[model samples]
Target: MQVTTTADPAEFMATAGDWLVREPVENNVLLVHALDPNGVPPGDREPVFATVTDAGAVVGTAFARSPYRMTISDMPAEAAVALAEHLAKEGEPVPGVNGPTGAATAFSARWTELTGQRVGNERAQWIMRCTETTRPVNPDGRPRLATEDDQDVVAEWFTAGMRDSGLSPEEILRRTQHMVGGQIANQRLIVWETSAGEAAGAAGWNPPLHGVVRPSGVFVSPNHRDGGIATLVLGEVVARALEDGADACVCTHFLKYESMLAVVEKVGFRRLVDVVEHIYE
Candidate 1:
């Protein structure tokens, strides 16, 4: 097996796309593609690496977008150990993050073996899927799609959502434009308003693919919390997704979102994966 680096984002994305189309669930190609497309340019960004066998078959791949942070799709235990050792020898400060718990644990263990840094506690990520339809009963307000003129407000809300979720502002902004453009193309934003025509809460969903759509930026202002505004916002977004032919919709919430969890559960969403956000220190 040989690991090679690529500087062209387009080529990397193409290769990654081919890999994903062949093994969608196994490789997490969609998530990586989305991140890469929305990521900032590699002016100073670390180069991405593709792993392939002697026969030129791609096996496992990883990329270091930011210094001290690496994201991997898959890797064997021995290859992971080798990667860790190589990074350690180069004195690279690696903080690993990814979906595969086994690979992550093995990599962390190997990193410690080489660098003497202990692994930290793992946090939980809940991947929730929408299973049933529960439209909001109180039609006290109408849902309106956001327009291009609303970019400022939308950007502010997006930044707030990212900050609330502990994402980097620069990275979030780079991704937000892509997400917002998608929202506009799909007419995905829904705003809950009061009888006075004031915005109470808002939510956005991307276009459906493979019968699935993921909702993003579900938020209610502080003054509007606990009044079922979030529930209304989510209901509108789910309804939109379903109307667009989505058989299912997904959203993620950290373990801390007790209220959000309850709202999603009440609306017929099921928990799928306990996702963890592993940050490199």
Candidate 2:
């Protein structure tokens, strides 16, 4: 197995585009970045890209924006270990790694051996996909596209949601502004308001890449719990995404976020895989 690195986004895509496209949902993060390298969270710097090949065919891929964990796609255990060892030797300062549980386990173990950093299992989440929309029971109100005037409130909610999910303080700070700015700039941020015109919830999605779009930043305020507002808003979000030419809508949320899980499933999303994230400081 040989692992080659590339800094040029186009070059990395050209090398592993086919493999990633073949399993776009599984490689959603990489696909989104390849389409728009600036799409990731802020404070993300010094991108590291690697394509693992055996007998001259692409077998696996990995990416990291330094100071954060690496995200990797499915690969042989040996390849995963080699990639971790290679990155450590190359002086990569990664805070953690995220991927399928088995692959992350292998990579984190090897990384520990190489760097003496204790590996900590951070969280587990589920990757879900919806190919067909279930008719959503629209509640009392309509979905409203958030406007510029709503930035402050929306950013607060976005940041709060990140914090609630146990995202690191550094990550929450780094990403809040970009998350709010990008969502509004892209016209993807939305709010669900009640018949009384009270904004009960908000959610957003990235632009479609490789015919796949992932919706996130979904939140319903505490005053409005168990109202099916999230279901109403997210159902529309997923439908609009697919209608906009996305072949599928993908999402990954913490397993502990039962409300998100319930709403997504009710709206026709089927669980694809459970991903475990590991951190090595």
lDDT of 2 by residue, 48-151 (tens): 78898889899889887766668888888888888887888888777888888788788888988989999655788878889989545565888889888877
lDDT of every model, 2 decimals: 0.63, 0.81
* TM-score per candidate: 0.74, 0.92
Task: Give the Cα-based TM-score of candidate 2 against the true structure.
Answer: 0.92
lDDT top scorer:
2
Q: Which candidate gets the maximum TM-score versus the true structure?
A: 2
Report how far off residue 233 is in candidate 1 (Å).
1.9
lDDT of 2 at 242: 78
Model 1, range 49-164, lDDT digits (tens) per residue?
54433457665666655432466655566666666666576565565555455556667777877876675546565667784586777756777887776655665666677764
- Over 4 Å off in model 2, which ranges? 135-139, 164-170
